[model samples]
Target: MREDTTVSALDSLYLANSIFEGKLLQAAAKYPFTVSNFFKSFDDEPLGITTSADGVLIIYWWDTLTGGTQHAYSCVAQYKTAHGIKSVSPASPNKYSCSYSKIYSLKSKDKIYYLAVYDEILSYHDRCQGIQIFLIDKDDLMPAKLIKTQTGLHSKIDYLYNDNSMRDQNWENELTYHEKTQTLTIPVALENGNLTDNYITYKFNGEYFIKLKSK
Candidate 1:
């Protein structure tokens, strides 16, 4: 995460989302797509860059907005090279999301994954307490098929919501990575006050790092 932001962390995200609104619009226009009959998908919008030994793949996130608010986030991938555009990943909405796409590579740099985890800020009371994980594939930059998680991973966003105004940073990963094991460990609090040192772990599968267990 970029810690240099003088303002709050999520505030940095919120600011980024707002600041790049124009770029988003332009990206959406560049690759027009429709998600469903009811929604216009922006899965083609390039919001991230993937650096892999295989090659550079541009990442895209389509924000489905309704009534001036984001309803869904769709991910897409584009293959790039000096000669020309080599290929394009599926226009389909993969798990592409992240305030900023942080790429984690395995033994090979080209073989990697993108991570996006965010706390549901608009949630009212505890109804919206949890961090949403959207993991994207290295090849497609689309949502990986193996893993996705929502709750039991983040400390709840409670009454202090209004007090903080910008929200809490509990959603951030308190991490431990095992090189040989290829595991990412994140310590989070339970929602119902079950445990304070609850740890959720993800093991890198062949394609993605899926949630292994929590305790």
Candidate 2:
């Protein structure tokens, strides 16, 4: 690449970073984000954004230090910065760490639901996965409320399995949140070392997501 072209690209990236940082900082003021348990030295720009039907905006982001990366979800709607934070995840030599995947959201009748799927990596094949469901009240735009958490969830997309592992289910499948039906569906492993042909579906009752028949 030419020198000017490279410089222009770098400039664009910097500009984008600046804009995102300013927006996030402004949003954090009124609705303070819950800091990670493992303190971070710096964080990255918002990875993505998901908005509810009612116009509530939630951002997915992560921060890191020498130890590990911690991800968070934040709302942006006339907020002040709750605290000051750095803006980069320093390079680390270690491989084993805990991190979250891209956040997902589902809009129900009057509320928006968020999902955080996390993995704790101990080694190449030794890891534990979990899921946390959150509900944000659109009326107030307050911090998300934790509704439920489930551990030991398997991930075909993020995991590497042996060649002899069951292949009946589509390993490329991911969780699907249907807006029209207000349903969430994903494949589940059976006790017999096989995956269900039909993906299991869940619906939000008054309190939490309840398992419904597979679609």
Cα lDDT tens digits, model 1, 86-162, are: 23333322232222233343443553443332322232332122222223343233443334345433211111122
Q: Scored by CA lDDT, what does every candidate get? A: 0.40, 0.42
Worst 10 residues of 1 by lDDT: 154-163
TM-score of 1: 0.38
Q: Per-residue lDDT tens digits of candidate 2, residues 1-103?
A: 5555345654665566557656655444433342221113223433433323333333334332222233222222221122332222211212333355534
TM-score of 2: 0.41
TM per candidate = 0.38, 0.41
The reply for model 2, stretches above 4 Å from the true place, is 1-27, 30-55, 63-110, 115-122, 126-131, 137-171, 190-198, 205-208
